[model samples]
Target chain A: MTHELATLEKQVADLRAKLEGIERRVPSNKLSMVVFSGDLDRALAAFIIATGAVAMGMDVVMFFTFWATPILRDPAKKVEDKDFMGKMFGTMLPKGACSVKLSKMNMGGLGTAMMKNLMKQKNVASLDQMIALAGELGVQIYVCELSMELMGFKREEMIQYPAMDFCGVAKFLEEAMDSRIQLFI
Target chain B: MSEAIHADKVMDLKGLPCPMPVVKVSKGIKEVAVGQILEAQTTDPGSLTDFPAWARTSGNEIVETIQENGIIRIFIRRKV
Candidate 1:
Protein backbone atom coordinates (compact mmCIF):
# COMPACT_ATOMS: atom_id res chain seq x y z
CA MET A 1 0.00 0.00 0.00
CA THR A 2 2.83 2.43 0.86
CA HIS A 3 4.62 1.58 -2.40
CA GLU A 4 1.49 2.36 -4.42
CA LEU A 5 0.99 5.62 -2.52
CA ALA A 6 4.59 6.69 -3.18
CA THR A 7 4.25 5.90 -6.88
CA LEU A 8 1.04 7.94 -7.05
CA GLU A 9 2.77 10.89 -5.37
CA LYS A 10 5.65 10.68 -7.82
CA GLN A 11 3.24 10.75 -10.76
CA VAL A 12 1.47 13.76 -9.32
CA ALA A 13 4.75 15.60 -8.90
CA ASP A 14 5.74 14.84 -12.49
CA LEU A 15 2.41 16.08 -13.76
CA ARG A 16 2.77 19.27 -11.77
CA ALA A 17 6.20 19.90 -13.26
CA LYS A 18 4.81 19.38 -16.76
CA LEU A 19 1.96 21.76 -16.05
CA GLU A 20 4.39 24.39 -14.83
CA GLY A 21 6.42 24.04 -17.99
CA ILE A 22 3.33 24.53 -20.12
CA GLU A 23 2.19 27.53 -18.12
CA ARG A 24 5.56 29.15 -18.62
CA ARG A 25 5.44 28.66 -22.37
CA VAL A 26 1.79 29.35 -23.12
CA PRO A 27 -0.07 32.71 -23.23
CA SER A 28 3.16 34.69 -23.33
CA ASN A 29 4.72 33.07 -26.41
CA LYS A 30 1.93 33.60 -28.92
CA LEU A 31 1.14 36.51 -31.26
CA SER A 32 -2.13 37.07 -33.10
CA MET A 33 -2.74 39.64 -35.85
CA VAL A 34 -5.92 40.62 -37.65
CA VAL A 35 -4.80 41.64 -41.12
CA PHE A 36 -7.61 43.79 -42.47
CA SER A 37 -5.80 45.78 -45.14
CA GLY A 38 -4.83 44.66 -48.62
CA ASP A 39 -2.62 47.66 -49.27
CA LEU A 40 0.97 46.84 -50.07
CA ASP A 41 2.48 48.90 -47.28
CA ARG A 42 0.05 47.65 -44.68
CA ALA A 43 0.59 44.06 -45.76
CA LEU A 44 4.32 44.63 -45.48
CA ALA A 45 3.91 45.91 -41.95
CA ALA A 46 1.85 42.90 -41.01
CA PHE A 47 4.39 40.48 -42.42
CA ILE A 48 7.27 42.32 -40.80
CA ILE A 49 5.65 42.02 -37.42
CA ALA A 50 4.77 38.39 -38.00
CA THR A 51 8.28 37.50 -39.06
CA GLY A 52 9.77 39.44 -36.19
CA ALA A 53 7.60 37.69 -33.68
CA VAL A 54 8.37 34.32 -35.21
CA ALA A 55 12.05 35.11 -34.96
CA MET A 56 11.56 35.83 -31.28
CA GLY A 57 10.22 32.30 -30.91
CA MET A 58 6.60 33.29 -30.74
CA ASP A 59 3.85 31.35 -32.44
CA VAL A 60 2.11 33.74 -34.85
CA VAL A 61 -1.35 33.65 -36.40
CA MET A 62 -2.34 36.21 -39.01
CA PHE A 63 -6.07 36.29 -39.70
CA PHE A 64 -6.80 37.84 -43.10
CA THR A 65 -10.25 39.33 -43.50
CA PHE A 66 -12.24 41.82 -45.57
CA TRP A 67 -10.03 43.89 -47.89
CA ALA A 68 -7.05 41.93 -46.66
CA THR A 69 -8.35 38.75 -48.26
CA PRO A 70 -6.85 39.69 -51.59
CA ILE A 71 -3.38 39.34 -50.11
CA LEU A 72 -3.91 35.61 -50.16
CA ARG A 73 -5.49 35.38 -53.60
CA ASP A 74 -3.50 33.85 -56.41
CA PRO A 75 -2.93 36.32 -59.22
CA ALA A 76 -3.53 33.72 -61.90
CA LYS A 77 -6.42 31.88 -60.26
CA LYS A 78 -9.89 32.86 -61.45
CA VAL A 79 -13.07 32.61 -59.47
CA GLU A 80 -16.02 31.13 -61.33
CA ASP A 81 -19.74 31.00 -60.39
CA LYS A 82 -19.65 34.57 -59.12
CA ASP A 83 -22.75 36.69 -59.09
CA PHE A 84 -22.81 40.09 -60.77
CA MET A 85 -21.54 41.87 -57.68
CA GLY A 86 -18.85 39.27 -57.21
CA LYS A 87 -17.83 39.59 -60.85
CA MET A 88 -17.65 43.34 -60.48
CA PHE A 89 -15.50 43.00 -57.40
CA GLY A 90 -13.31 40.48 -59.10
CA THR A 91 -12.84 42.85 -62.03
CA MET A 92 -12.33 45.99 -60.00
CA LEU A 93 -9.93 44.92 -57.29
CA PRO A 94 -6.27 44.28 -58.04
CA LYS A 95 -5.74 40.66 -58.97
CA GLY A 96 -3.94 39.19 -55.97
CA ALA A 97 -0.91 39.47 -53.71
CA CYS A 98 1.18 40.58 -56.65
CA SER A 99 -1.13 43.46 -57.67
CA VAL A 100 -2.10 45.03 -54.35
CA LYS A 101 -1.81 48.82 -54.29
CA LEU A 102 -0.61 51.20 -51.61
CA SER A 103 -3.11 52.84 -49.31
CA LYS A 104 -1.80 56.35 -49.92
CA MET A 105 -0.54 58.17 -52.99
CA ASN A 106 -0.59 55.06 -55.13
CA MET A 107 -0.24 57.15 -58.31
CA GLY A 108 -2.03 54.58 -60.42
CA GLY A 109 0.09 51.74 -58.95
CA LEU A 110 3.38 53.40 -59.87
CA GLY A 111 3.94 54.31 -56.24
CA THR A 112 3.70 50.67 -55.27
CA ALA A 113 6.17 49.73 -57.96
CA MET A 114 8.54 52.39 -56.78
CA MET A 115 8.19 51.17 -53.22
CA LYS A 116 8.97 47.62 -54.36
CA ASN A 117 12.03 48.88 -56.17
CA LEU A 118 13.15 50.78 -53.11
CA MET A 119 12.66 47.73 -50.95
CA LYS A 120 14.65 45.67 -53.39
CA GLN A 121 17.46 48.20 -53.53
CA LYS A 122 17.54 48.39 -49.76
CA ASN A 123 17.68 44.58 -49.50
CA VAL A 124 14.43 44.30 -47.62
CA ALA A 125 12.48 41.15 -48.28
CA SER A 126 9.34 41.69 -50.32
CA LEU A 127 5.90 40.74 -49.07
CA ASP A 128 5.95 37.51 -51.04
CA GLN A 129 9.34 36.62 -49.61
CA MET A 130 8.18 37.44 -46.11
CA ILE A 131 5.14 35.23 -46.58
CA ALA A 132 7.41 32.43 -47.70
CA LEU A 133 9.62 32.97 -44.68
CA ALA A 134 6.63 32.93 -42.38
CA GLY A 135 5.62 29.62 -43.89
CA GLU A 136 9.10 28.24 -43.45
CA LEU A 137 9.05 29.38 -39.82
CA GLY A 138 5.64 27.83 -39.12
CA VAL A 139 3.64 31.02 -38.77
CA GLN A 140 0.00 30.14 -39.28
CA ILE A 141 -2.01 32.04 -41.89
CA TYR A 142 -5.79 31.94 -41.50
CA VAL A 143 -8.48 33.24 -43.85
CA CYS A 144 -11.80 34.47 -42.59
CA GLU A 145 -14.48 32.14 -43.96
CA LEU A 146 -17.21 34.76 -43.68
CA SER A 147 -15.11 37.26 -45.57
CA MET A 148 -14.53 34.75 -48.34
CA GLU A 149 -18.25 34.06 -48.69
CA LEU A 150 -19.14 37.73 -48.65
CA MET A 151 -16.41 38.64 -51.11
CA GLY A 152 -17.35 35.71 -53.38
CA PHE A 153 -13.92 34.18 -53.10
CA LYS A 154 -13.62 30.46 -53.55
CA ARG A 155 -11.16 28.24 -51.73
CA GLU A 156 -9.39 27.49 -54.98
CA GLU A 157 -8.84 31.17 -55.65
CA MET A 158 -6.21 31.46 -52.96
CA ILE A 159 -2.55 30.81 -53.57
CA GLN A 160 -1.35 27.49 -52.20
CA TYR A 161 1.71 29.08 -50.56
CA PRO A 162 2.11 28.87 -46.80
CA ALA A 163 -0.81 26.39 -46.51
CA MET A 164 -3.67 28.53 -45.18
CA ASP A 165 -6.43 27.64 -42.81
CA PHE A 166 -10.01 28.97 -42.83
CA CYS A 167 -11.83 30.05 -39.72
CA GLY A 168 -14.29 32.63 -38.32
CA VAL A 169 -14.04 35.50 -35.83
CA ALA A 170 -14.97 33.21 -32.98
CA LYS A 171 -12.00 31.04 -33.67
CA PHE A 172 -9.74 34.07 -33.97
CA LEU A 173 -11.03 35.44 -30.70
CA GLU A 174 -10.27 32.15 -29.03
CA GLU A 175 -6.71 32.34 -30.29
CA ALA A 176 -6.39 35.97 -29.28
CA MET A 177 -7.51 35.17 -25.78
CA ASP A 178 -4.42 33.08 -25.25
CA SER A 179 -2.00 35.24 -27.18
CA ARG A 180 0.15 37.85 -25.45
CA ILE A 181 0.28 40.09 -28.50
CA GLN A 182 -2.75 40.95 -30.64
CA LEU A 183 -2.82 43.55 -33.39
CA PHE A 184 -5.57 44.72 -35.74
CA ILE A 185 -3.99 45.83 -38.99
CA MET B 1 39.26 46.26 -32.34
CA SER B 2 39.47 42.90 -30.58
CA GLU B 3 40.45 39.60 -32.14
CA ALA B 4 37.58 37.88 -33.97
CA ILE B 5 36.14 34.72 -32.54
CA HIS B 6 35.93 31.66 -34.75
CA ALA B 7 32.47 31.00 -36.17
CA ASP B 8 31.07 27.74 -37.43
CA LYS B 9 29.11 29.56 -40.14
CA VAL B 10 29.10 33.01 -41.69
CA MET B 11 25.79 34.58 -42.83
CA ASP B 12 25.93 37.65 -45.03
CA LEU B 13 22.96 39.96 -44.48
CA LYS B 14 24.67 43.09 -45.75
CA GLY B 15 22.32 45.81 -47.05
CA LEU B 16 19.24 44.08 -45.61
CA PRO B 17 16.81 46.25 -43.70
CA CYS B 18 15.36 46.06 -40.23
CA PRO B 19 13.95 42.62 -39.35
CA MET B 20 15.40 40.72 -42.28
CA PRO B 21 18.81 40.58 -40.68
CA VAL B 22 17.31 39.27 -37.50
CA VAL B 23 15.00 36.96 -39.37
CA LYS B 24 17.84 35.52 -41.39
CA VAL B 25 19.97 35.26 -38.27
CA SER B 26 17.23 33.37 -36.49
CA LYS B 27 17.07 30.94 -39.37
CA GLY B 28 20.81 30.73 -39.72
CA ILE B 29 21.32 29.99 -36.08
CA LYS B 30 19.25 26.85 -36.52
CA GLU B 31 21.76 25.51 -39.00
CA VAL B 32 24.57 25.81 -36.45
CA ALA B 33 24.98 23.19 -33.78
CA VAL B 34 24.57 24.07 -30.15
CA GLY B 35 27.59 25.89 -28.67
CA GLN B 36 28.85 26.65 -32.20
CA ILE B 37 29.09 30.25 -33.42
CA LEU B 38 27.42 32.05 -36.34
CA GLU B 39 28.85 35.25 -37.74
CA ALA B 40 26.30 37.56 -39.41
CA GLN B 41 27.37 40.62 -41.36
CA THR B 42 24.75 43.33 -41.97
CA THR B 43 24.41 46.99 -42.80
CA ASP B 44 21.05 47.40 -41.10
CA PRO B 45 21.50 49.89 -38.27
CA GLY B 46 18.50 48.39 -36.56
CA SER B 47 20.39 45.12 -36.00
CA LEU B 48 22.57 46.78 -33.37
CA THR B 49 19.54 46.57 -31.13
CA ASP B 50 17.59 43.87 -32.93
CA PHE B 51 20.31 41.22 -32.62
CA PRO B 52 20.73 41.64 -28.88
CA ALA B 53 16.98 41.62 -28.36
CA TRP B 54 16.56 38.55 -30.54
CA ALA B 55 19.42 36.80 -28.84
CA ARG B 56 17.87 37.50 -25.47
CA THR B 57 14.43 36.30 -26.47
CA SER B 58 15.63 33.29 -28.45
CA GLY B 59 18.00 32.15 -25.70
CA ASN B 60 21.11 32.61 -27.84
CA GLU B 61 24.21 34.55 -26.89
CA ILE B 62 25.77 37.41 -28.82
CA VAL B 63 29.44 36.94 -28.15
CA GLU B 64 30.79 39.82 -30.18
CA THR B 65 29.61 42.79 -32.26
CA ILE B 66 32.06 44.53 -34.61
CA GLN B 67 31.40 47.65 -36.65
CA GLU B 68 33.66 48.66 -39.50
CA ASN B 69 33.11 50.91 -42.48
CA GLY B 70 29.32 51.02 -41.98
CA ILE B 71 29.16 47.24 -41.77
CA ILE B 72 28.18 45.35 -38.60
CA ARG B 73 29.40 41.88 -37.79
CA ILE B 74 27.69 40.00 -34.98
CA PHE B 75 28.89 36.69 -33.67
CA ILE B 76 26.10 34.62 -32.09
CA ARG B 77 26.47 31.41 -30.14
CA ARG B 78 23.63 28.96 -30.40
CA LYS B 79 22.50 28.00 -26.92
CA VAL B 80 19.87 25.44 -27.70
Candidate 2:
Protein backbone atom coordinates (compact mmCIF):
# COMPACT_ATOMS: atom_id res chain seq x y z
CA MET A 1 0.00 0.00 0.00
CA THR A 2 2.84 2.40 0.84
CA HIS A 3 4.61 1.59 -2.50
CA GLU A 4 1.40 2.30 -4.41
CA LEU A 5 0.99 5.63 -2.60
CA ALA A 6 4.56 6.60 -3.39
CA THR A 7 4.07 5.73 -7.06
CA LEU A 8 0.91 7.82 -7.15
CA GLU A 9 2.73 10.75 -5.59
CA LYS A 10 5.50 10.46 -8.18
CA GLN A 11 2.97 10.40 -11.03
CA VAL A 12 1.29 13.49 -9.60
CA ALA A 13 4.62 15.22 -9.36
CA ASP A 14 5.43 14.37 -12.97
CA LEU A 15 2.08 15.73 -14.12
CA ARG A 16 2.66 18.93 -12.14
CA ALA A 17 6.06 19.39 -13.75
CA LYS A 18 4.57 18.91 -17.21
CA LEU A 19 1.88 21.45 -16.43
CA GLU A 20 4.52 23.95 -15.33
CA GLY A 21 6.49 23.42 -18.54
CA ILE A 22 3.37 24.04 -20.61
CA GLU A 23 2.59 27.18 -18.65
CA ARG A 24 6.06 28.48 -19.31
CA ARG A 25 5.69 27.82 -23.05
CA VAL A 26 2.97 30.37 -23.63
CA PRO A 27 3.28 31.71 -27.21
CA SER A 28 4.78 35.13 -27.67
CA ASN A 29 4.21 37.80 -30.33
CA LYS A 30 6.39 35.80 -32.69
CA LEU A 31 6.13 34.16 -36.09
CA SER A 32 8.19 31.06 -36.80
CA MET A 33 8.45 30.22 -40.51
CA VAL A 34 9.95 27.27 -42.37
CA VAL A 35 11.19 28.36 -45.79
CA PHE A 36 11.15 25.15 -47.76
CA SER A 37 10.98 26.61 -51.25
CA GLY A 38 13.79 28.21 -53.26
CA ASP A 39 11.58 29.60 -56.00
CA LEU A 40 11.86 33.33 -56.54
CA ASP A 41 8.18 34.07 -55.96
CA ARG A 42 7.92 31.91 -52.87
CA ALA A 43 11.11 33.31 -51.37
CA LEU A 44 9.66 36.79 -51.90
CA ALA A 45 6.49 35.75 -50.13
CA ALA A 46 8.42 34.30 -47.20
CA PHE A 47 10.56 37.38 -46.72
CA ILE A 48 7.54 39.61 -47.33
CA ILE A 49 5.64 37.92 -44.54
CA ALA A 50 8.73 37.92 -42.34
CA THR A 51 9.38 41.64 -42.81
CA GLY A 52 5.70 42.41 -42.34
CA ALA A 53 5.66 40.45 -39.10
CA VAL A 54 8.69 42.36 -37.88
CA ALA A 55 6.97 45.67 -38.66
CA MET A 56 4.05 44.54 -36.52
CA GLY A 57 6.43 44.34 -33.57
CA MET A 58 6.47 40.54 -33.61
CA ASP A 59 9.69 38.54 -33.58
CA VAL A 60 10.21 36.55 -36.79
CA VAL A 61 12.35 33.42 -37.28
CA MET A 62 12.90 31.80 -40.67
CA PHE A 63 14.30 28.27 -40.90
CA PHE A 64 15.78 27.78 -44.35
CA THR A 65 16.03 24.13 -45.29
CA PHE A 66 16.16 21.90 -48.38
CA TRP A 67 15.71 23.93 -51.55
CA ALA A 68 15.52 27.21 -49.64
CA THR A 69 19.10 26.97 -48.38
CA PRO A 70 20.56 27.89 -51.76
CA ILE A 71 18.72 31.22 -51.75
CA LEU A 72 20.99 32.48 -49.00
CA ARG A 73 24.19 31.68 -50.85
CA ASP A 74 26.14 34.70 -52.03
CA PRO A 75 27.01 34.74 -55.71
CA ALA A 76 30.14 36.78 -55.19
CA LYS A 77 31.59 34.57 -52.47
CA LYS A 78 32.54 31.08 -53.74
CA VAL A 79 33.82 28.29 -51.49
CA GLU A 80 36.50 25.98 -52.88
CA ASP A 81 37.66 22.44 -51.98
CA LYS A 82 34.18 20.94 -52.39
CA ASP A 83 33.62 17.30 -53.37
CA PHE A 84 32.53 16.32 -56.90
CA MET A 85 28.90 16.00 -55.81
CA GLY A 86 29.07 19.33 -54.00
CA LYS A 87 30.42 21.05 -57.08
CA MET A 88 27.67 19.53 -59.19
CA PHE A 89 25.00 20.59 -56.73
CA GLY A 90 26.40 24.11 -56.50
CA THR A 91 26.48 24.39 -60.28
CA MET A 92 22.87 23.19 -60.64
CA LEU A 93 21.39 25.30 -57.84
CA PRO A 94 20.58 28.97 -58.16
CA LYS A 95 23.44 31.19 -57.04
CA GLY A 96 21.49 33.68 -54.94
CA ALA A 97 18.09 35.30 -54.46
CA CYS A 98 18.31 36.94 -57.87
CA SER A 99 18.98 33.77 -59.82
CA VAL A 100 16.03 31.66 -58.67
CA LYS A 101 13.28 30.88 -61.17
CA LEU A 102 9.51 31.05 -60.87
CA SER A 103 7.61 27.98 -59.72
CA LYS A 104 5.49 27.85 -62.88
CA MET A 105 5.67 29.09 -66.48
CA ASN A 106 9.31 30.03 -66.25
CA MET A 107 9.37 29.75 -70.07
CA GLY A 108 13.17 29.53 -70.14
CA GLY A 109 13.46 32.50 -67.77
CA LEU A 110 11.31 34.87 -69.85
CA GLY A 111 8.41 34.75 -67.43
CA THR A 112 10.69 35.32 -64.49
CA ALA A 113 12.32 38.27 -66.19
CA MET A 114 8.94 39.69 -67.15
CA MET A 115 7.68 39.32 -63.60
CA LYS A 116 10.78 41.08 -62.27
CA ASN A 117 10.23 43.87 -64.76
CA LEU A 118 6.66 44.24 -63.62
CA MET A 119 7.69 44.36 -59.96
CA LYS A 120 10.28 46.97 -60.77
CA GLN A 121 7.78 49.14 -62.66
CA LYS A 122 5.30 48.83 -59.81
CA ASN A 123 7.95 49.78 -57.26
CA VAL A 124 7.37 46.54 -55.38
CA ALA A 125 10.27 45.21 -53.34
CA SER A 126 12.22 42.40 -54.97
CA LEU A 127 13.28 39.21 -53.22
CA ASP A 128 16.79 40.54 -52.60
CA GLN A 129 15.37 43.76 -51.21
CA MET A 130 13.02 41.86 -48.96
CA ILE A 131 15.83 39.67 -47.66
CA ALA A 132 18.02 42.70 -47.03
CA LEU A 133 15.12 44.45 -45.36
CA ALA A 134 14.54 41.41 -43.17
CA GLY A 135 18.15 41.60 -42.03
CA GLU A 136 17.72 45.28 -41.24
CA LEU A 137 14.47 44.54 -39.40
CA GLY A 138 16.16 42.03 -37.09
CA VAL A 139 14.36 38.97 -38.48
CA GLN A 140 16.31 35.87 -37.43
CA ILE A 141 17.57 33.81 -40.37
CA TYR A 142 18.40 30.24 -39.33
CA VAL A 143 19.90 27.83 -41.83
CA CYS A 144 19.36 24.10 -41.34
CA GLU A 145 22.69 22.46 -40.67
CA LEU A 146 21.46 19.09 -41.93
CA SER A 147 20.57 20.61 -45.26
CA MET A 148 23.97 22.26 -45.40
CA GLU A 149 25.69 18.94 -44.87
CA LEU A 150 23.60 17.23 -47.55
CA MET A 151 24.09 19.99 -50.12
CA GLY A 152 27.70 20.79 -49.10
CA PHE A 153 26.96 24.47 -48.57
CA LYS A 154 29.56 26.31 -46.52
CA ARG A 155 29.01 29.07 -43.98
CA GLU A 156 31.49 31.38 -45.68
CA GLU A 157 29.27 31.58 -48.79
CA MET A 158 26.24 32.84 -46.90
CA ILE A 159 24.93 36.35 -47.47
CA GLN A 160 25.86 39.16 -45.10
CA TYR A 161 23.04 38.96 -42.57
CA PRO A 162 23.26 40.32 -39.04
CA ALA A 163 21.16 37.83 -37.06
CA MET A 164 21.82 34.75 -39.16
CA ASP A 165 22.90 31.37 -37.77
CA PHE A 166 23.60 27.82 -38.91
CA CYS A 167 21.57 25.64 -36.56
CA GLY A 168 19.73 22.35 -36.40
CA VAL A 169 15.98 21.70 -36.62
CA ALA A 170 15.64 21.47 -32.86
CA LYS A 171 16.55 25.14 -32.50
CA PHE A 172 13.87 26.10 -35.00
CA LEU A 173 11.35 23.77 -33.39
CA GLU A 174 11.94 25.29 -29.98
CA GLU A 175 11.24 28.77 -31.39
CA ALA A 176 8.27 27.53 -33.41
CA MET A 177 6.75 25.90 -30.37
CA ASP A 178 6.66 29.25 -28.60
CA SER A 179 5.61 31.36 -31.56
CA ARG A 180 2.06 32.62 -31.96
CA ILE A 181 2.14 31.81 -35.69
CA GLN A 182 3.99 29.05 -37.51
CA LEU A 183 4.23 28.99 -41.30
CA PHE A 184 5.75 26.47 -43.69
CA ILE A 185 6.53 28.27 -46.91
CA MET B 1 -18.12 65.31 -49.16
CA SER B 2 -15.85 64.70 -46.12
CA GLU B 3 -13.36 66.71 -44.16
CA ALA B 4 -9.66 66.25 -44.70
CA ILE B 5 -7.73 64.10 -42.25
CA HIS B 6 -4.83 65.90 -40.58
CA ALA B 7 -2.32 63.09 -40.55
CA ASP B 8 0.87 63.00 -38.58
CA LYS B 9 2.69 61.50 -41.58
CA VAL B 10 1.82 60.66 -45.16
CA MET B 11 3.22 57.83 -47.30
CA ASP B 12 2.89 57.85 -51.05
CA LEU B 13 2.79 54.21 -52.00
CA LYS B 14 1.21 54.91 -55.34
CA GLY B 15 1.53 52.25 -58.08
CA LEU B 16 2.80 49.64 -55.62
CA PRO B 17 1.17 46.25 -56.12
CA CYS B 18 -0.64 43.90 -53.76
CA PRO B 19 1.14 43.04 -50.45
CA MET B 20 3.69 45.77 -50.95
CA PRO B 21 1.22 48.45 -49.93
CA VAL B 22 0.60 46.92 -46.54
CA VAL B 23 4.26 46.00 -46.08
CA LYS B 24 5.26 49.54 -46.89
CA VAL B 25 2.65 50.86 -44.50
CA SER B 26 3.88 48.49 -41.83
CA LYS B 27 7.43 49.78 -42.20
CA GLY B 28 6.30 53.37 -42.49
CA ILE B 29 4.05 53.24 -39.42
CA LYS B 30 7.13 53.72 -37.25
CA GLU B 31 7.10 57.44 -38.05
CA VAL B 32 3.88 58.06 -36.16
CA ALA B 33 3.49 58.12 -32.38
CA VAL B 34 1.39 55.71 -30.37
CA GLY B 35 -1.79 57.75 -30.88
CA GLN B 36 -1.05 59.77 -34.00
CA ILE B 37 -2.54 59.07 -37.41
CA LEU B 38 -0.69 57.63 -40.41
CA GLU B 39 -2.00 58.22 -43.88
CA ALA B 40 -1.09 55.91 -46.76
CA GLN B 41 -2.03 56.67 -50.35
CA THR B 42 -1.85 53.78 -52.76
CA THR B 43 -3.26 52.87 -56.15
CA ASP B 44 -3.36 49.15 -55.46
CA PRO B 45 -6.85 47.67 -55.13
CA GLY B 46 -5.68 45.24 -52.46
CA SER B 47 -5.06 48.05 -49.99
CA LEU B 48 -8.83 48.45 -49.57
CA THR B 49 -8.88 45.33 -47.40
CA ASP B 50 -5.20 44.98 -46.64
CA PHE B 51 -4.93 48.23 -44.69
CA PRO B 52 -7.81 47.43 -42.36
CA ALA B 53 -6.64 43.85 -41.93
CA TRP B 54 -3.06 44.87 -41.28
CA ALA B 55 -4.19 47.51 -38.81
CA ARG B 56 -6.37 44.95 -37.07
CA THR B 57 -3.58 42.40 -36.70
CA SER B 58 -0.91 44.97 -35.85
CA GLY B 59 -3.05 46.31 -32.96
CA ASN B 60 -3.54 49.62 -34.68
CA GLU B 61 -6.91 51.28 -35.24
CA ILE B 62 -8.12 52.03 -38.75
CA VAL B 63 -9.63 55.47 -38.87
CA GLU B 64 -10.95 55.55 -42.43
CA THR B 65 -10.24 54.39 -45.98
CA ILE B 66 -11.14 56.82 -48.72
CA GLN B 67 -11.22 55.86 -52.37
CA GLU B 68 -11.12 58.45 -55.09
CA ASN B 69 -9.95 58.07 -58.70
CA GLY B 70 -8.43 54.66 -58.15
CA ILE B 71 -6.37 55.97 -55.25
CA ILE B 72 -6.91 54.57 -51.80
CA ARG B 73 -6.19 56.88 -48.88
CA ILE B 74 -6.19 55.02 -45.61
CA PHE B 75 -5.81 56.52 -42.16
CA ILE B 76 -4.68 54.40 -39.23
CA ARG B 77 -3.97 55.33 -35.64
CA ARG B 78 -0.79 53.78 -34.23
CA LYS B 79 -1.38 51.86 -31.04
CA VAL B 80 1.69 49.65 -30.89
Model 2: chain B TM-score relative to the native chain B: 0.91
lDDT of 2 at A29: 89
- Give the per-residue lDDT of model 1 (tens digit) for B1-80: 45569989999988778778888888889999999999999988889999999999999999999998998999999998
CAPRI-style quality class for the chain A–B interface of candidate 2 = acceptable
lDDT per residue, candidate 2, A1-185, as tens digits? 99999999999999999999988878988999999999998898898789878766689999999999999999999899899989998999999999999999899999999999988987888888888888888999999999889998999998999999989978998999899999999
Top-lDDT structure, candidate number: 2
Interface RMSD values, listed in order for every candidate: 0.9, 2.3
**What would the per-residue lDDT of candidate 2 be over residues B1-80, giving only the tens digit for each residue?**
35587899989989877566776788888888899999898998877877777878889998888988878888889898
Candidate 2's TM-score:
0.86
TM-score of chain B of 1: 0.94
Ten residues in sequence with the least summed lDDT for candidate 1 chain A: A89-98
Question: What is candidate 2's TM-score for chain A?
Answer: 0.88
Q: Could you tell me which residue pairs clash in candidate 2? A: none
lDDT of 2: 0.89
Name the top TM-score candidate.
1
